[model samples]
Target: MIKTGLYFGSFNPIHVGHMAIANYMVEYTDIDQLWFVVSPQNPLKKKKTLLDDYHRLELVNRAIGDDLRFRASKVEFGLPKPSYTIDTLAYLSEKYPTHQFFILMGSDNLESIHKWKNADVLLANYDIIVYPRPGFNPESAEKYPRVQIANAPLMEISSTFIRDAIKEGKDIRHFLPYRSWDYLQQMNFYKK
Candidate 1:
């Protein structure tokens, strides 16, 4: 069975930091492939600044262009408005029986994961590959049976910073994949 790692995020523009973590997970870890699971905005709350779901997915697709080991998943798009990890995992497992799926997340996120929906069930069932983030130490997460701390490089860049940079007319093209940057520019995203 293929070991698939699911990296869920808003991927506002799919920046270099996101790619770095994914590449490290696939190349350095036991994961055979990595999927960028683009998260749709919650319908309960109106987020005027967030781009359309399909557009974000398209950005992920472009960012992963020509990479055989990387894929973009829109599974959450058809699910509930505020899709939960447990539900998404259940759907993916039922749909793809041959692939062994695991969750990929940052050390920062791991700290607050206990508050997530069905956190116990998720932590108990799936393997979590945690990438270190600046200021957040995930060494304590090793206590969990399924949590594995990855020696992946610490990434500091954030999508929020990228968006703010774009709005400021900054040259942040190098922060994203070339194809993705082109698409983001063509679509005029993150710019007022």
Candidate 2:
């Protein structure tokens, strides 16, 4: 059976940190392939200045390129708003019955995961791969036995920080993937 890991995120702009976590998950975990599931909207977050969903998805694709092990998916775009992980997981399970699925997330997300829709079903069915986020510790995963904490290289870069730098006319070359950086510059994205 093919093992696949679903890494769901807003990825308003795909950055090096997001890529690092996805790379580490497949390299270090049992996951054979990692899909960066670009969410249209996160229920927990306030939708104010979110980048266009297609643009965000395109950025993720640019960052991932033709990596056979890594893929970009817009599974939630067809689904309802505040895309629930459980609902997506259920849909995927039925759609791809042959592939085993796992959820890849950051420690920060796990901190408030209990509040998610059908959190109990998600915990009961799928395995979770949690990586450390900047300012967030890994100890929080101890509470969830099904969670696997990854010791991947912790990158401090975040989309928010990258956006801020771009808006402020600061350099962000080092924070995003080279191709993504080039694409962003070519399109003049994130400039205030």
Candidate 3:
């Protein structure tokens, strides 16, 4: 069975940091494929600053363009609202029985993982690869055997910072992929 790493996120504006994490996962871990599962709606996050789901998905596809190991997924878009990771995982497992799924998350998410719906079941069922996040201490994750800390760099760059910078008319080309940056500029996204 192919080992697929499911990296779920809003990807409001898929950036270089994201690319770095995906690269790290594919190179350092046994994960065969890294699927960027673009969540249309995260139950924990506010939707005010989120871009359209299709647009976010397109940006992810453009950001990861031509990468054979990486894919942009819209699996959560068709699912019920306030998308919960547990439900999505179940659906993906059923649809792709040949693939063994692993959850790719950051230290920040690990900190509050207990609050996620059916968190215990998730922790018990699948492996979780935790990448570093700024200001987040990953010591708490050590309690779970399924959770492993990845060697990916701790990139302080975030989608919120990117959005705020764009709205302020600040240049964010350095933080984003060339194609995604160009798309943002052409579409006038994140500008208030």
- For 24-97, candidate 2 gives per-residue lDDT tens digits of 88889999999999999899997776888998889999999989999899999998877999999988889999
**The 10-residue segment with the lowest total lDDT in model 2:** 132-141
Which candidate ranks first by lDDT, i.e. highest? Answer: 3
The CA lDDT of each predicted structure is: 0.89, 0.88, 0.93
* Colliding pairs, model 3: none
Q: lDDT: which is higher, 1 or 3? A: 3
Candidate with the greatest TM-score versus the true structure: 3
Give the distance in Å from residue 64's predicted Cα in candidate 3 to where it truly belongs: 0.9
Candidate 1, residues 1-192, lDDT tens digits: the string is 999999998898789999988999999999999999998964333567788889999999998989999999999999987878889999999999999998998887788788788899999999999988877666588679899899877778998899999999999999999998999889888889
- All candidates: CA RMSD (Å): 1.7, 1.3, 0.9
Model 2 stretches with alpha carbons more than 4 Å out: 134-139
Two-way TM-score contest, 2 vs 3, winner: 3
- Weakest 10 consecutive residues of candidate 1 by summed lDDT: 41-50
